[model samples]
Target: MNKVTTIDLGSNSFRVLIYDCLNHKIINEYNEVVGMADGLNETGNISLEAQERVVDAIMRSSKSLEYDPKSAVCVTTAAMRLASNSNDVLKYFEKTTGARFKIIDGKEEARLTLLAVKYALKRERIDSSKFILLDIGGGSTEIILNEGDNFNSKSFNFGIVTLTQKYLTSNKLIEELDNWKKEINLFLDELDINLEDFTFVATAGTPTTIAAIKLGQDFFHYDKDEVNGTIVNLKDLDESLEMFKNSNNETITKLVGRGRVEFIEVGIYIYKAIFEVLEKNESIVLDDGLREGVAIDYCLNKSI
Candidate 1:
């Protein structure tokens, strides 16, 4: 059946996706919030607690899935990139989990993400020659502009987890909103392309969560197929924010999944900011992202 597993060791979560290369279908999937970048903003290193969580998640998932850790295509993102002790952390993960994880730079991260998004667009039959792809991650945000055969991408350092740790957890999200928007705008302005001509598309947690909420689906009932290609309007996003704000801890967790209640607000804030800056009232949300891209890239390279 030619099944292969891909692990995305994200800053906020660890995701394992198994894909059948021969059939081009997903075999199984698992995700756990490890908060790998917890306190990374201040400590300049991944916390021992966070590292332990990752190792534990990896060990459990590897055992449950019965996948060879050495053969899995595992990639760590922004957290590892920014961590001062990433090498030590990587070695530790290898020793404990038997998984060798490669830390991908922001640009490479964007490229791999693009592959998945492109595949989704094609599968959904969304025909567009020009589009702007936004991926809001835990430690970095990547914006990619794809027009015909040309592509340009930029990665910003601040993301939901980092922003939450730096501001929201301190009750400063409101105070820091303007500055955050300005920083995002600065990066967008550099693209120097007329955004009006491009279709805005968003991937990753924020958009998918918004899509699920808009569809009235909670974590337990969340369906990726239904979420994919859903259009999220700005007004709906604002309303969702309000709903999240009013909801209690249990409700928020029920809606957004565990380990995400605290981060979702900051994530939505980032999502709204990007939409407003690009002058778009709505965006096409996709459920496919980096992990899917990794699997697809691997299969293509192997001619599977």
Candidate 2:
């Protein structure tokens, strides 16, 4: 059977996936949160520590997975795109890990992500004719509208990590909520599309984490099959937010994961704002994202 590997060097995490192309199944998967964008907003560049973390993650994951770096479809997103020293960082990563990475633009990122979401919907026997896909990442959020062959997408600069660094760390989370909502609303207004006409589907960590929580799964017991295709209601998200607010850091970490405790609240807040502005009460959550998309796209191009 033909096999392929994919690496998603995300702003908040690094994920590696091994796929059996012929069987259309995943062989193995690994993920680690390295906070690649931790101090990017303040410096406009990737910190040396973050760069070291990424290189270490890449080497370790590749070594343990026994995958060849040369053939892997490795992609980096918003953090790299916005980093002024991305070229230098990429060179350092290549020299240290022997993995070539591509910095995909927002449009390409949306396209690849949509590819994964469509495949997941098909596997779940759901119609994908019309839907609005929301991907809330660490450095940016992508809003994609798909109507048959027509597609429109936009990427917003604010996300969980950046927002947390800007507001939560500064003790302005509560005070800045309204301003954040207004900013998101302004972007939605620019879309000029009737959001109510499309089904709302969300991918990435935030929705999947919410789905996991709703399914009574914790970090140690997460089941992607149960999390994927799960319908998460706005009320459920609000309740989760309240619980997180009242709970301590350790408790939140047990549910979401180690590196997510600090950003979960900000992520949930962003999701709530999006749902409120779009009048979306519920969303279909999926675990499949850019990593899956990269593998699928690679297989397709190779005619595997």
Candidate 3:
């Protein structure tokens, strides 16, 4: 079996996952939550600081992937796609490190996420209609209406860091979040989406963080088998929201994962809002997503 690595350079983090492509299984995964999106607001772009750090992280990983740097496909989403200076970032990374990173648009990101969900359900032999896939990214959230192996999708501007900086202005962030929730609900209501027909497949850092809290774990350790059909109470998420509001950023960084500390509460708001919109008090976390989707795409397409 051939080994191939996939790099998903997301707004909140940069992740590299190596897989036994033929066998369709993960071998090893490395990630760093650089909060690369931190200064996106100030510069109207992915910060030069982030670009330099990203280059260093990728170069570090490149040493380990020395066998075939060409086999590793690095791609960026949301933040890069939305940033004004994204082209410069891409060009610089490619020029300095010889790593060509593609900035995927919303539609392609949606397609990859859809592919991820499908691959997961097929591998596990679970019903495809079982859940609605939600990927809460740093710059955006990708929503896929999964129904019996076919899905309809949408990419929204709702993101944890963006929301935190934009709306988490007061203790009344929850109420303000309600307005955002209303938009989600209105969109779904317009579509007449069937809530009972679907379970929630929450992905990305935000959902994972909420899941970690629910399990009372302090780190990012979770088993897909343990979580597959499990559900998390919306009220538990609501409790977390209150917990975050009470704590300071420094405390949050100390307690929760590092990169997400400052915006964890904001993420909670988005997650809780989705729970409310779905009208289900609970959600299931899928630790597998995007990167897996990209790997599966490479495998099936023989991208290597």
TM-score of each: 0.95, 0.94, 0.89
Rank order (by TM-score, best first): 1, 2, 3
The alpha-carbon deviation from the true structure for residue 188 of candidate 1, after best TM-score superposition, in angstroms, is 3.8
The candidates, ranked best first by lDDT, are 1, 2, 3
Output the better candidate (1/2) by TM-score: 1
User: Mind sharing the TM-score for model 2?
Assistant: 0.94
lDDT of 2 by residue, 1-304 (tens): 6989999999998999998888778999999999999999799999999999998888888889998887788999999999999999999988877888999999989988998899899999888999999999999989888889778888888789988988744357655656766776777688777877899999999999999999999988999999989999999998998999899888899999999989998998888877876788999999999999888888888621
Off by over 4 Å in 2: 169-192
Candidate 1: clashing pairs of residues: none
Write candidate 3's Cα lDDT for 1-304 as tens digits: 6867888998888888888878888888777776677767667787777888888888777776553445578788888877898888888888887777888887788788778777776666767765777888888887778667566677887687766766536556777667777777766777676788887777777776666667766654545455554466777787887888798776566556677787777777778778777877677676777787888888789662
Which one is best on TM-score?
A: 1
Residue range 1-304, candidate 1, lDDT tens digits: 8877999999998999999888778899988999988999899999999999998998899888888888899999999999999999999989988899999998889989998899899989996589999999999989899998778898888888999988745357755756766876777688788888999999999899999999999999999999999999999888998998798999999999899989998999888878877899899999999999999999989621
Each candidate's number of clashing pairs is 0, 0, 1
Residues forming the 10-long window of minimal summed lDDT in candidate 1? 168-177
